[model samples]
Target: MKTLLHAAGLAAWLAMSQASAGISLNGTRVIFDGAHPEASVTVRNHGADILVQSWLEALDSDKAELPFAITPPLTRLPAGQEQLLRILYAGAGASDQQETAFWLNVQEIPQAAGKGNVLQLAVRQRVKVFYRPPGLDGDALQAPERLRWRLRRERGNSWLQADNPSRYHVTVTGLTLLSGGKSKEISRAQMLAPGAGGQWPLPADTANDARLRYQIINDFGASQAFEARLQGVAPAQPQRLEP
Candidate 1:
């Protein structure tokens, strides 16, 4: 009954192997914009039990471990079902060109099992950052004057006037809107001489709740910019003048 015992032992080993199962991760990739980056992975479970826990890993070209590894939230996958997991890389700084090599490590904890299994998946992606440079005009170039905007009259269309003195060949560059808790680029122009500094006609439906920033650029790549608040004020009603 030595033969019978040996056969029984082999059957038990096969049964144990079949019982311990895991999920497979496929089609892993990292996506990066100039400002933000994200990772996506596809998980497929082929075992008879559910998978409850999972993790990921990222590596460089030399197989060195990355300082930042994303662990997706714990989830359960029914047997033979698949799901997609996503992770975001929230880093700072603006580098135009940086190569980020990465990969995925998917771990699955099977239900009613004491130990979990891990699967290794691979991925690679590059990062790109972008920015704009300030522009300049001819010799009459000087640092752009700081703009202090004031409201003259409130009417149908809002009007804004800057207390700036016009200088020849000195144009404004890098005029931007840093309002609504966000930054946005604006157009540039050369101010004509002999008049009130510069006037920006506020558009109808314009919310006077943003800070304006502007810069003066010279021919030599030199620039200066400043910020000013666009304080909210009550609109004035049109007054009828006696003839």
Candidate 2:
């Protein structure tokens, strides 16, 4: 499966927790249907009373105003149960391949009882909509024009580094096992720009038998696959065992 790498600035706010009594949005993800995009908003209640609120704003990728807002007639979310708010873009005139941002602003509501309201709050979330064209297939990769990798061992720790000095983005998608067999994918990522490099931390228990195989995918629907062997030994302990 493919996942979009979130821009650096937006990652911080998306990781916040909203389990408190005040209004908050959590577990937000964008789903694109090629023609229309849907933003699912979940509002959690951590207090004793129900939540009644109104419209929220949605923005585009450039931080511009989207012509849509999320205003359900009656948003009554009971304590602990989440309310799923769906915002559709069917009527909104937009392109399929273009990327846009959807921002949400949650309004606050006053408490029903005579006591002062403590549930007044506002939260924002963003979603990117992109179109996925058809006729794409997955296949094994060929070697790239240039390939370089390194393995370094330290005190009970090792590092694996890979570099792609070519002019295309590379995808590493597979892993090889240590016991003369292949294993399922452990991790995958795209390497951007020429001269870009990445480092992977190796576990202390992994000895000379461990190995990793990776594939490099380019933007033009081509890929390169290779393997890297890792040799490790346990860090020497100062004391010897008594027999």
Candidate 3:
């Protein structure tokens, strides 16, 4: 029986996550600094003959202020081949106070096979593109440590509130709240916007004083762990874990 997978799989992938993709990016994410003329990333194809189309997309609701230009937007990628995607910055119009975030979408176009019942599929991958402007206020690495946390209870619901006061985006990858004897694990990656505070609902919270262990993804996309004592007002900042 002939099977169809191109549209349905692509739609499901867009709504959710996929186990794997036909093409892989060399880096986890891309960082385009304002001081540099451009940035590039390596895209390698698996054992599939497909067309790779890459383009920059705006993450914000307003799309009038884009400042990036991608080269080789559409190219034919053979089996087990690789190519370099160059991202040239316009060098203007981005905010100088805070880092801007964008989405780089790499989509795979499936080629037809000369068979009777072939399962054709197309895959897509998205990576965060962080554009750090020149003369930013704070360092990207130190932005995680500057965060403060406190347990907020409102309307019979307990939430872990995280306050970020830095100019760079801080992505929280792992979190665990430990009480006297019980521990609740929160395993989700959430990006805290610059100069903003966010709250995540807690499964349970009954400790008088708890230890908050949180992990953040750094500039290179590596997870680093940190811990702090949860307070009524978050007096103590997060301390980095010692290697």
Candidate 4:
């Protein structure tokens, strides 16, 4: 446990120093290997002594319970110090159909010093945690690029479907439809795992042959753009990739 803790701190410190100023995470995302008992995350405290709290919550509460726990849920993080946190999956069982996505919330609480109406706000950081079962096929890094986009209709209702065929999770950060020289951005933020899919209701007047341009959240917590056309139409080629 101690070694795991040490490793967690190192990872957090390396990943978050410049981008996150006061507190940084070791990695952009947490991948929990189901064959193992737990995963590790490091939190580095670059500011003054503060209290840090963390927890895990499931995205689809209706499907399964949030079965993960973060050790040392709340602790005093001394200035210039770092600590490794453990995420243990204690749920009934891992999802067999697809990778389960959860949210890891880490909040930093700073003391309030009354100095002329000072505002001492607590800064909370949230990151995606993907629970991957053993024996899942395909590479996670390629999952985003492998996603299939299509326009579907059922009972006179049209919707945009994004199917994930890879054995990894794809986090869609932004989506838009293009048709008749008109572009409409769809508001959606969800992760689709291997063998799973997501559908967004399209506007009643949306073009049936509209193309889709979406952004996937990469491992670094950054968005990467990609384009695809409806299933029956010719594929929409990508323009330029975001660096």
Off by over 4 Å in 2: 1-19, 22-26, 35-39, 52-65, 69-74, 112-243
Give lDDT tens digits, candidate 4, residues 90-123. Answer: 7567675558788898888776675686535577
Q: How do the residues 1-243 of candidate 2 rate in per-residue lDDT, one tens digit apiece?
A: 123344543354444424443555664333334333555567766655565564534332455455554547357766666677766564455433233334355554535556674333343333332222122122112224344555557887866566655433344655443423635354746443344766666554445555556655433334445565544432211111122
lDDT of 3 at 46: 76
- Pick by TM-score: 1 or 3, better one: 3
Candidate 4 residue 8 C-alpha distance from true site, Å: 41
lDDT order of candidates, top first: 3, 4, 1, 2
lDDT of 1 by residue, 41-147 (tens): 56777765555454444332555444444545567878888877765554533222323334455566645645676332222222211111112122133223323
Question: Residue 95 error for model 3, in Å?
Answer: 0.9
Mind sharing the TM-score for model 4? 0.73
Error of 2 at 234 (Å): 42
TM-score of 2: 0.36
Clashing residue pairs for model 1: none
On lDDT, the candidate that comes out on top is 3
lDDT of 3: 0.83
Ranking by TM-score: 3, 4, 2, 1
Give each model's whole-structure lDDT.
Answer: 0.48, 0.47, 0.83, 0.77
Which candidate leads the pack in TM-score?
3
Candidate 1 at residue 126, lDDT?
Answer: 24
